[model samples]
Target chain A: MPRLRATAIIPLLLLAASAGCSAPGANDDDAKSGSGPIKIALVDAQSGQLSSLGAWELKGARLAVDEWNAAGGVNGRQIQLDVFDDQGDPTTGTTLARKIDSEGHIAMIGTAESAVTIAMAPILKQAEIPNITSGQSPGLVAAGSEFLFLNGPTSTTYDETLAKYIVDKQGLKSIAMITNNGSYGKGEHDAFLKALSSRNVVPVADQVVTTDQKDFSAVLTGIRQKNPQVIFVGAEEVESGLIVKQARDLGITVPFAGAAPQGTPVFLDTAGAKNAEKTIVSSPYLSNDVSDASKKFAAAYKAKYNEDAELHGAKAYDGTQILLTALKSSNVATGKALADAIRGTKYQGLLGDFAYDQTGVGIFATSIGTIQNGKLVAVTG
Target chain B: MQVFLQTIIGGVSLGAVYALVALGFSLVYRTMGLVNFAHGNVVTVGAYLASTFYLTSKLPFALAMVIAIAVTGAIGLVIERVLRPLENRDFDLMLIGTIGFGIVLDALVIAIWGATGRAVPSPVQTEPIDLLGLRIRTYDLVVLAIAAAATVLLVLFLSRTKRGAAMQAVAMDHEAATAVGIHVGRSNAIAFMIGAGLAALAGGLVGPLLYVSPALGGALGIKGFAAAILGGFGSIPGAIVGGLAIGVLDSFTAGHFQGYSELVTFIVFTVIIMVRPTGVFGERTVNRA
Candidate 1:
């Protein structure tokens, strides 16, 4: 009886140890299994001051994923999305990128603002994972990161268009430029100067404001002294709104023009409709005019989120579409293969036709929009 | 000259709202010896509640403002009750608690309302009146008038009314007031309620001019705090003066310098602190029985 009992106990112990070892092994196998869905990561600002825009981007990306998965995902494998909120901070963005990289996503679509995207570039590059950013910062592509891609217009393009608009359309002879002092702001300022120099138009005053600034009285006073016919703002919506509101209070009546950051709804809300109405901005997409893809995405987004998708949403959707298309075209599912395929992509999207140049900047056209009656209206292409 | 006059007028009007917000901070700090860091969040809650009433319930603007003030006052009471247990705790711990509470309020707002800057229609007419050669919005003038009335009423109440006198007694000396038959807890509650109501009023006034968003309170809060500090933390008149001064400084700096308004404001604040550490109207305290 004792011998039989010992034999039974030994078999049971071996079975239990095998089960314990296989449980974790099964989890590892589940993660490594190519037959399962391909996971993609999205890291962007989903909280803080820019949360509204961030949520909009999330809605658009989610819609694209839903549509892609429904219409037969890449090679019959569903696409799974893992989203991270960086709160619009560059440091937080870098940390999130590292975490996402370690988790081993096939690719990432994200980082709406230029500052965060530029900070996240090294992490994604180190992991050999390709990422398509929604930010227009040229620095992301300028870094020569083989894995980086930009889906928005660079400051150079926007400045060229803006300078032409102010000089030709508005007939402004003298201009004053007030820009935030940061990488994004500096890029815009440099681009504006270059474009104006090309057109033989010299600015009467060029001034800089720190990003943390809330007051603009001294800057406005200087601009008032110069008495330029127009004022150009190269900053995000919060500072831009404060500038406009304060300018009106200070009785400076120059027409205000800004880049894509000023085109958001937050600008109107923060500065009031009266102040926002005087501003003109350029963007790649407007909510009013919907292409077939945009309309579908908007409908799905509204149904799920009960709100309209803003420009950030449209860009995220386009970026994800480009990423998924490249992944579908490439047979090898590794990160290197995905990066190469993305580099060779020429996909048409909601923003416009996207063709990446050698530097990984999306070669596309931008549309101009004006804030009228508290809504973004497309003005000119 | 007309443009300069209009600019000053506009600055004063904007300053009126800031002054009201600063008054709340000043009143609370004077009485409680604690800076209610959640004061701005209280303002935000008031603005959002008013927006909901105006948009969802279709209430009149006046009714909505009244309801918002009442709701925010209740919230203030609840906050005081929740914090009453920690009254004897260290000042830093209380401050950290308030900061944590502010974060909770901000997050709750986002979860409930989602992250969107909703448009709040201005009750005041949209017409821009010509002041000299410059056009000034009517809503701004109204804000100035309301702030003036609130200041006068608060001053009168504190000076004349029995409850107000008791409140002042408590602010002056909590232990002595309690020994002299004043209910210190009740007085504190009343002071907080009044402060919260003023903050809500400021919120309602500014909501039409600016959209109500979860993050809108942060900058305003910082500025209001700065205004209070500039004015000598415990003085009501100082808050008003300080707010107007900051507003004018901001306008002038932006108008004259174009890009260095923040630096200019910082310089002014630093100068003021250096010149008068006890604040413009603050009394130098001496340790005594």
Candidate 2:
């Protein structure tokens, strides 16, 4: 009887899921081009290790959509942004791409994970649905999808700026690197390595770890033996935080450097305030107080979510704004026209001024920041 | 030399955690003839429970850990009860059931804890102390001592106690043990409870090393399984030895080889499996009946 009940419920669950998938564009024909709510899909890792990224992206995009709706949404159509959990898996991401395209989503926001974004790019390109991703992986650009857009500067820009500050400005050349073998980590590894090589600085130790590895003791110990002046960590927030924490526990007192994820609150809290201090970060959005525009965005974001805004949130907000602006300027254009509109749209973002090129990379620069008292502060020369 | 000692200490510390987890697997498999795949998530649940009790409720860490272990053991009893109905069914059915149980536990953790990683504070100071010219955390040393003591007590319990003997008898031959008036069901329940309690204890001990998160179970679970298999599945002493060996080997390779830690460890594991189908300490007898 129990088995029979479970078997009976399985199909119902599937049916409910399919029903939920198609609900966003219920009036499909009208949503495609006619008068209807502008349907956009936000796909991200809503659960799993990368869910924090998903939460940030969702909030930022939601904030933008909410603000726009309050001020009479684009072209007199209230934008309906539906969210889908990609679970941080590329296969799930590809499946979501199909679901969103079929559901008449004009555009997509998110998949902060680079691998997922890269996996979904081809399908999204074939469907001609414009997507703005928060992933900074150079591989995302290398995917070479015209419909694919990056909300933030690529890892190349981030690491180059970081390298300049570390090797040229700070004059630290004896660097060590520890990166995971994931898409994001690989991108950072290569980009940072290239930047270091260009500056004639070779990392004394380079350790590539598995993405899911929790125990960083052995790798950190090996790096300690090298005695590098600075450690260039190229993993995500949690892993990087663990690395720093373990490094500190092992009594390695040298400062660490990284791009983007190293500056977040998750990293700060995970590593503990004392351990995360002096960690260098290169990011387009340094803090929530960079400018008056940022101050307003951060304030509004805090009011809505009751959480401090970070780089990912800022990037998502910028991307969503760019998408909405393009949609409006092009008069609710769909397909290639919308993609072109996004490419052509120019606006100032919380991160920086956005002028997207043919390659869909809008921003090209990042500023250096240091973790001071558990807060990521802009580093002044 | 200092690096080698550091690696050894780190490996032993990690191995102790794995030993606790592996014991859970060995106990369940030994007594019930069922490999409890949900044992991995039990470790996760244990960690999250300890975090809640210690961090949120402001309970003393030791008391919190005891409560966590008790709760985890209760969960184990529930799982055993659920699986009891499927005992006479196919082995594959039981295996799949345990896997499903693990998934449910994983989902439950996410639902309750909300998927964000939370830091579990170490009871001992996190700072390393230089001992014999090698830096090691006091927490790691404490874990090693606790695990060692637990293993010794467990081995003694199985060998010297009446209930342990009954459990051994059930493990050896379920029908024969039942015929001899040994309550096989009670034995199975006790084994599961103790096994799960050990896993929870492991989780509480290792929580500070790895942040308490939903994904923590899957990462550490596979290693525990590997340790159990390598040490000889269902062998208590074997589990400890296997776990320590794997930890040391992993640390040695990871410290020396930049990107080949998993490869080297697996190569050694595979070689061991190929050489000894029954594992390092597994008995030659098979009591499938």
Candidate 3:
């Protein structure tokens, strides 16, 4: 019995010794590579209605991490990701931001919705952590934080480009606008109005609706009564599709233009081929750009995920690449150094020349696309 | 004048959906005495099921709706069977269980359909019909018509059918009904099935008008619950009225005061509860003890 107990103790001691050896070696390697593995916290609507967008963002981030690791990770340190599901709620987002900030992550990505992102801005700023987000509300940047970076075009830019395309190219003088009553909708509405004012044009009619609203007959009727040459819808895909379908049902056959949120496949699928066929939208990135890099990314993404990547996914991919590039450029691997490196980035991305403004907003390019034949076709204005 | 008319029409169409959802809440409450917080999640499940049929199986819209409703009804039955044994449990426990069930259903939806909002194609056209110098979508009118017809049929069934009366009896006095040969358990199951069917119907109808997401039911569920309470927990007509009123109030409020809509709407709820504790149509129940 004593000999048997001795034999069991010997194996247990060896196992403990091996674990001790590996654990310290791992920590030493992490330290040598800088701060034990770069911790990235991703906050988004992972379990809510907008989970699809979150899933896409995750896929994009994962793709970037995989590529980076394959090519030898940033300064020989592996990337570690921690994800939090905000469920598209601002309060939840704020809490998650606080938690991520306190957890000592190198940087953060997401809180995909504009309202949630804006709500989290102060928390992220207080923590002095850099946040790269896919939200488009201009208010996000207007928060006056150098650490908060918007990966997409501001709502004003999307509105300005759309208004230019409509009033200048389409040559439509009279226009009607219908927008949701959220921060995003209000931002787009104000921006569109400003853009129209610049062109010496004023909308004949404007209608506001809520995000949960399912019917648009009244708004469509108001627009019809005004008899505008064009109708601009400043809402997301679901609401936009309903407006288009309802407008057509009401015999209002004017051309409809949408903001960036209406650029997704959901718009086409929901609005049906007939309603979506001629609908025009301004997008930051196009899946069918035919550029070598764009095609390569598209092919790889489709091969891996078996789905066409949307602009949000592409933005996240680019955003992750930007972070990785910044980390690679700087020898040190601290939060402040990573932030500084990111601020000084000038990498060529799938979207365009990726650079950050002093305010940390991505100075990448955007484009316009139209839904034709149930697919997004790149439209050159 | 035009904006007012349009707002009313939009409000009515939206109210029709709320009414359908509220009816589900009323049906379950009338029979079970327990609030199925998962009712809205059930609607989401129905919508996703319909979408699956429509998109994956290439079923016609009408057929897809039927299948979705049937599937949702089955889910309701399953929930009833699983939960009935715990009926004697604490009210808070039951409520928590339903809430947990809702979360599970929501997560399941995400796993299956992903979290992205998908566009539900409306069977109606985009052309607007002129009514009294106001243009309205044919689909809105269709929704209103469907809601009215469904309500009438449901009222008729509950008032005239033996099965409906048996269910009502179970709701009124479960012990007494059991003493009489009403098969209270079967009535409970049937009540849940009907409620789930109604929710599923609402999902199918509204799918085209809004994007269907896994979380679509969260807000709607809250509103439906509010409507159920505002209409006097178990009153069918009260649920309908309350739902329409809430819908109209929400539309006008949001239209007039964009950012303050949520606050204003909740204020209305608070005012209603304070003014009428038993609700607009609720009866004050006598304590048996």
Candidate 4:
């Protein structure tokens, strides 16, 4: 009886394993013919702490894909956009990269966390799978994978522009900085510090914090002693909000400045409106009402998601649109040919003009904005 | 001097929250000989419950806290009852079971609350008060006062109440307490309820100061365990002292050293544990006489 059971189970196990390994475009014939629906994997943290990024990315990507599909989808072949949750973890991202590669996804979008994107870059490069990411970390560029593309400007560009405004134009010489130890934070820290040094100004206090730290009293207290004109925050939305709120509680009324994360809804909501007021932000996509095209996109986004569009969603939408445009123009090419097509195609996006350089950084400029009355408005000349 | 006072005040207030969580760790370990890793999730549950009640249902903040605490205590009873069958088994089995239970609670928190962080409204005026030329948040002072009142009440109850003494007896010897006409299971249940109640109070109090999110538990849980270990496991006063020490060290290190705050704090804990294996106030013997 035991021998007979083993014989039956062995064949069943083999069949299941084979089925599990099978994927949509895994066949060589399918890859060459460019037949069937085009598969593009959307990787982001669909659950856990960074799920907000994933949710926004999903909505933006879905909106673009749905629009394309409705309009006959790049020469009559529907684009199949599949979602994969990375849990904001690098290890999970690597696993998802391998899965997407084997599953015959021609291109990929997101893995919003910079660390996860950097970790998956090599794997995607080896698989010849071109990916567009929403991560703004300079480390993504440092990864030096031609297959990896960014949807927005790096922290370097953002901080440089911010420094030019705050130092050269406004002349806020005395500054204090509080940053976390995460990949995004490190990039902002280095870029902003370099930008500050270029102007021959040194921060009065530079406090480094852990990424997951909730309390900012100790660090804020230390900064209070210095009494800087402004505090440069090199952290994400929630952390930056906490820092601003705590700084206010400590009676340090200096305005806080940061990159993309500071302008987000999460940051504004976390820090009460009164506390978040006058916060300076540097980003390519300042608001959804920047232009006529932006106004149209924002209307559509709100119509679909029933929520106002933000930087992450705007970037994702722009990235997805760029990817689809390249796919259409290249006649739905794959691998190196598709990558060349993406690089070759130039188009105006919601954020800015899309033009990829050698380092996969498409955009190179960010306008300065400030939070006023609970809304981020661009600083008009 | 002003900065020094501010740091100490900030540390002590944060420490008060840790002390509340540490008390839960001490209570469960004493009566059940189980660390009850799910205590952190209980904290998260309480925060979310209070937030939901206050923000969604438009209940008064104080009333929301009361409902949250009561519900959390009931959850404690349920958890203890569910684990009753595994109580007599190997200690590791119960430890692993509690960890698994914690994961389930964490997942439930996400499913119900959604994985986003919500700002809980502060019951007290969020503005800082001028005290001795130092700026201190009014909410921090309230947190410290509540913790002190809770500690005093806990000490008084353990010394003067029948149920509390029964819990202590059970902690000393399960079989002996069972033979002495004390209902061992009842005593254990009471311990868990009280412990969970304290955790809920901590969560509600700290919720406004920090973002109430699913990951709040994991971040606070490690610090609570460290406070428990530093205080010598089962000692109440020791937990408070340990928590304050850890908070002060964390604040001071971050203030002065900046980059090495966590490293310095953990190193101090490691060195203290290595030098004194039984913790500051831990009993020298395996079983209390």
Candidate 5:
């Protein structure tokens, strides 16, 4: 099969070589094109289940790229941003990762869904280039991909923060966790359970759901029997919203806490404004009140795109800005040096003072916020 | 006891939705002798229309529901006509064709409304009613009532009315029905319209619980198909029975097995298909000439 495939590609390669024969030094000049826009790739679900989050990330990248270009193109070289839709499919993501590597982009930022990021990890690591990811799964960086850097607080971090808040701050005697069985959900579920155990707190109920399963009435009924102080959700926006809404439908009015995905517009919208009240989310971005940098980013994003910048977009913007900052200070930064520079540098952006740990994970504090009357009202920062 | 009661209540609401979608499938199968794969997307389109008219356009919910159902019926008519032109009515081709058309519909909905799901308000409050120590949503009761009413109306249309008798004739023997002056083509079109309209109603009714999105069509589509198969391909009561069975199975599994419930639902469907292809109570009798 491999030999047959290789034989098939031979003609395409010959055609490409025939095309490159137009100019002898043209290929060289093109490779070393001075003052040209530096190509950067983004891989995300532009048309599948996670497309909404993918669009937000794209918008955020555009904002960061435009802001930087407006300020003068990273000291003479403009940024060339390209996008590839992975549809949150690992196979598609792997192919896109190879395409980006073969295209020889300076860096890549993307993959809103963690499974895709993890799928592309080995390919990106093999390419020996910088790849920043905003996905929540620890597996994105945990795959030991030196090139893959986590751009935001991970699911583990959020779960830990949520568990700590409920136990230490709120002083809840018990809690319940409901999550999907996917990679993202499972990761958060285990991490949250671990955190609870570490705190010597036992959850009253633990339920697992599928990504496609929408009805939570049955599960909520069982959980209501446990009657915990709060419910922690480990699902995405749609599923999380459904869980909260159905929980209310089943007459369970306890406060619900969740990770970043829970506090999103779609979650609040799908869950209903009234149903979503008392639903707390752990975020790394500004929930309601904006900091100076956040205000600038939001204003520019709104002025340009005529839309609100969400958490996914905000984190991507910060990640892009960090890449820009790294590219600026070092004129000849490439490959290992670029990755090293990204790790070494510490910059304060929209999410706050941002830096990566030794293992290429973002070290950031968590903020608690709730959807109150259709708006994310920050309780703590 | 409460868990058992709550599971039954939840299952009933879910069963009503499955029944609506399955009823559409059964009607099309009976009339056309072919399963309509696009029935699911009809539901999705219905959802999008409801969101656009009722939620986004600020139209009254009842008015929006009616308009969406009417438009979906029209869409069904168009799809049936489109399929009628094919040179060969091969089962595999028809299956693929309808599925391909459904995908096209999916893309159209996504293009117009975007991929993210949104919530629509229900006439009843989302809050549950305490009925003898069991928690049940008022919305669930409404969905159950609507589904029951629609089923009764459908049964009446097929049994008591002129068109109803004609449909039964066509279902029994299309060529014989045409010889007796019943327009088989017209019957097929009506079947498609009723199927699509029922699907749309199901989508609209489910919006408050599942939220309105093109993605809603997918899982519901499969379950509805399974329900149709389980109950009997051309049996109206079969669709209801099949839907209720599947819904109850799903809720019970979700409560008992947690994450693996979907797997169990499909596994049971697979087993039943392998064991009894004609389904429970499905007529497998052949008329001796």
Candidate 6:
């Protein structure tokens, strides 16, 4: 009886080992992966200062993937997601994009960071893998990559209009801008400056800091001396928060206006809710008082993730929905076909309608908003 | 004038953090004759460990800080022992090994505490205070006080305590100190433990002002090395002076230059190295090269 049990155990162990050895080969057939389940790669700042935004964006992607898989995946194939941490570094982002390209993933939905996404676009384009991102830089679409799609508004696409609104409508002048030294940072900085110049408004100071910087005292001190009416911070949520907090701490109570820097909850957390108050931000998505579609998306997302959805997450969800629609519309389309389908299609999403034009730049519903009582509330331009 | 004073205060606060990190580097270098590239990441780990524990357990800030420092000290002990395996390895390779460990530690921070930056709520009220007609954050005062007190205690221990003298003796000549009945390996372990605790304390002190993030590891580590070099490689008083000097100069430069400030800081560092190869107060050159 003991000999019979040993023989049975040996055969079971052999079977398990054999199964493990065969599984990876069956799963990693990249060329055939597109024909089977659609693969979507996410390479973002998943583990750094910017990780909060990345986490929410990925959460949105996860929701979209789950919803699609539940309702039957695109063309009866399951959606497979491969995620990597770019650490908010462009080199790391490019490396991950190359890996994704080599793996032959059908498409990628990622890189909420404008600089990282900009770095990734060329690599994904060369590999002919369609990329849908949520970064708010005009350069993301303006680069004219056939493979790149943005669910968020481009920095310069309506930047001039936003700048005009601030100058003409808000009746504020003597603006100073602080920006991160990344691709998106330079793009938005130049756009704002150009727009301000077009309106014959010149900035008091234009300061640049690297992305890893946390201290803003020196820069803020310099800016405070200028005594600008509004300080425009052209950075993301966390840095914006730190800047706002530090500025206030140094007794510089001038209100801050920015291109989406004050829109996220992170701004409140980092800067303290009181410090972030009255800071105006331009955003493509509103956290509250939105359409029924947005309401449903926010509700579903909250129930699923147990957190309030930010703008990047909404954009990621919409981008993934767009990707799913494109996937379902064509059975044998290549990555270029997928890109073309997206550029041509008019997609309604939780954020708003997205319709990419010749430049692959899409217009989304946008608004200027302010932090009121620790929440982002839309204000009329 | 107010801006100038505020800049000084800001520099002092930042420099205090640098001094703490530098002090650790100097200690590890003195005891083990190793660069201990892992020193900075230990500060990052200590911060995350403390804040995560506080966030989860709702422990008092003081108690959480103690446990966190203790844990990092234990980790330091283990690390020193583990590096023993590379006893005969080339110093450069061992240096790389320490850096490799630091990278792994940083990665572990992301894996456990996660990638998002967390705010270590201040134990004291964070309202800005008026000091000598200058507006300063209360947290800045706490940071300066803690850093100064730590420096004082370190000085007192080295000058007054038997164990501290023994460690200093080991630092002076390990073989001679061993022959004189000082336990060299034990002193080395103690040196590491103290160095790690100081780093964690620095992390805790400054974490509220600069939110705790994994990037904190790399940022402060390089700056600490600069401070260590500026103060004289193995000098305690030099670390404080060098750190403050670097911090103040950096702040003033940034206040004026804005964008070019970081570039200016590095230039100054290079200039200092060129002018004073032995550093401001570095007594021994220890020319291994």
- Using TM-score as the measure, name the better of candidate 3 and candidate 4: 4
Local accuracy of candidate 5 as per-residue lDDT tens digits, A222-287: 899888889989988888888888888788889898888877888887788888887878888745
What are the per-residue Cα lDDT tens digits for candidate 1 across A113-161?
A: 7788888888888878788887776676677888888877788888887
Backbone clashes in model 6, listed as residue pairs = A138-A155
What is the TM-score of each predicted model, taking all chains together?
0.87, 0.94, 0.87, 0.94, 0.92, 0.92
Residues B109-136, model 6: lDDT tens digits: 8777677777665667666876664668
Q: What would the per-residue lDDT of candidate 4 be over residues B152-261, giving only the tens digit for each residue?
A: 99888877898888887788888998898999888878888988898889888888888888778776778888998898888888788888888777777777766667
> What's the number of clashes in each of the models?
20, 0, 12, 0, 0, 1
iRMSD of prediction 4: 7.0
* Model 5 residue A69 CA deviation in Å: 2.5
What does candidate 4's lDDT look like per residue over A1-381, in tens digits?
A: 123224434644553465467664444335335577787889998766777788788888888999999999987899878777788999999999998787667899997899999999999999999999999999999898989899999999999999999999898999999999889999999999999999999999888998877667778877888889989999988888888888888888889999999998988877878899999999998999898878988999999979999889989999999999999999998888888888877979899898999888899989999999999999988
Predicted candidate 3 versus true structure: per-residue lDDT over B1-289, tens digit per residue: 8778777777777788888899999888888787888999998998888878987799988899899999999999998888777775676787788888888888778767767767766676455677776666677788888889889988998889999988888888888988999987798899889899988988877777777887678777877788777877788898898888877877777666654666788798889889997788886362011
Tens-digit lDDT string for candidate 3 (A281-339)? 87777664647887888877898889887787888888888877877788745556667
> For model 5, how does the per-residue alpha-carbon lDDT over B17-100 read when each residue is reduced to its tens digit?
998999999898877778888889999998778767987888987788899999999999998787776513566777788898
lDDT scores in order: 0.76, 0.87, 0.77, 0.85, 0.81, 0.78
Interface Cα RMSD in Å, per prediction: 10.9, 4.7, 8.8, 7.0, 5.9, 7.3
TM-score of chain B of 4: 0.96
- Model 1: docking quality category: incorrect
RMSD of each: 7.9, 3.9, 6.6, 5.1, 4.9, 5.6
Candidate 2 chain B lowest-lDDT run of ten: B280-289
Q: What are the candidates' individual DockQ scores?
A: 0.20, 0.49, 0.43, 0.44, 0.39, 0.40
Clashing pairs in 5: none
Pick out the ten consecutive residues of candidate 1 chain B with the lowest summed lDDT.
Answer: B280-289
- Candidate 6 lDDT over A168-213, as tens digits, reads 9987778999987766677779889988998889899888876556
Report how large a share of the reference interface contacts model 1 reproduces: 0.27
- Kept native contacts, fraction for each prediction: 0.27, 0.44, 0.61, 0.47, 0.53, 0.44
